[model samples]
Target: MHIRRRRAVGRHDASDYGLRGAEDGAGADHPDLADRRHQADHPPGVAQVAPWLKAYFTPAEHHSPEMKEALRLSDELVAKLIANDHVVIATPIYNYHLPAVLRAWIDHIVRKGLTLGFDGKGLLHGKTSTVLMASGGIYTDGSPIRDRDIATQYLRLILKVMGINDVTIIAAGGAKGVDLSRVTREAFLERLDSEIELAGA
Candidate 1:
């Protein structure tokens, strides 16, 4: 099983961490599971989906040279999503939602003819997904601010639309403590070690 690890921020490559097969419970030691990382880099003007949409809607015969160029990255991203059995989206929440780059990545992958059908059916099936989200505040069950967990809900809905029903979300809430130096990063992560291991397995 091949898994695509998408890090919303390009600062780090997820492949370096060997976090493959987390969705299917195939532990990292699974011999057949391989990790393929795709960093969603924040290149200048790369997150604009309008140009790609314009090119995609234009008739192929009447497409300009620039149209093809506009579709290049979107096509590549969609193709990669289709090729993988499992997809891991590691992102940080921004203002109670997804970062611009991650949202752009979703826009690029949710293609009409490829990932989504014209009839509103999802083309990509039999796939699983894992969402690793770090948030500044706690919003899990029992939290008063749980209703503010828009990012998780949005991702689940989108993935379901793309025919990926089996999804696991590992929420690392209260991450601000790390930034504030109230809790060590290692200690915070250690608290979630079992959850992370189970998700990976």
Candidate 2:
């Protein structure tokens, strides 16, 4: 199966952490994953979503020249989703939720008659997804702030809406230690290696 990885981080950071681990575990050299055609190296531009929303709500505008141009990137993003069998989303939590760029990418992909159906059904079926999230605080079981794990919760709901019900979430919590110099990035990532490998497998 072809795997497409969408990451909401800079190229350097994306390669430095969980995304790279997942890629390696999934066999980066494998033919299906080797072709980077469907991978989104960086998050989409957040500013462009405004025009996309306008065109999305106005069905008549979909065929218009201006609207077509506005929706080009969104279409491409959705096309990638449709093409891949497995989707891996690597993102860092921002304020207990998705980063602005990742949210914009989500907005562009949840298109009616494309990824979603006109009858309130999802068009993207038989696809699976994995979300690799790095957060500053622990939000898993036993964590007092578990309810604030909105990023993971939101992603699960949205993926289900898009017809990807079989989803795996790898939560790499307490990542702020790397930023604070309390732990090296490599060491922090090592702790979640098994989880990342399992998800990729």
Against the true structure, what is each candidate's TM-score?
A: 0.77, 0.78
lDDT for model 2 comes to 0.68
Winning candidate number (TM-score): 2
**After superposing candidate 2, which stretches have Cα over 4 Å from the reference?**
1-51, 60-62
Q: Candidate 1: TM-score?
A: 0.77
lDDT (Cα atoms) of all candidates against the true structure: 0.67, 0.68
RMSD of each: 5.9, 4.9
- Write one digit per residue (lDDT tens) for candidate 1, span 1-201: 223243211111222122222343543444433233334343223445577668888877788889988988777767767877777776678789987666766777787888888898888788877777778899999999999999999999998888889988888788888778898867866776776667556
lDDT (Cα, tens digit) per residue for candidate 2, span 1-201: 113343211111233333354445444445444232134644466455676567777876346787788888777778767877777666778788876666767777888888889988888888877677888899999999999988888999898888989988878888888878888877987787777667656
Question: Deviation in angstroms for 38 in model 1?
Answer: 8.1
The superposed Cα distance between candidate 2 and the true structure at residue 88, in angstroms, equals: 0.5
Which lDDT value does model 2 have at 154? 94
Checking candidate 1 for backbone clashes, the offending pairs are 25-201
Clashes of each: 1, 0
Candidate 1 global CA lDDT score: 0.67
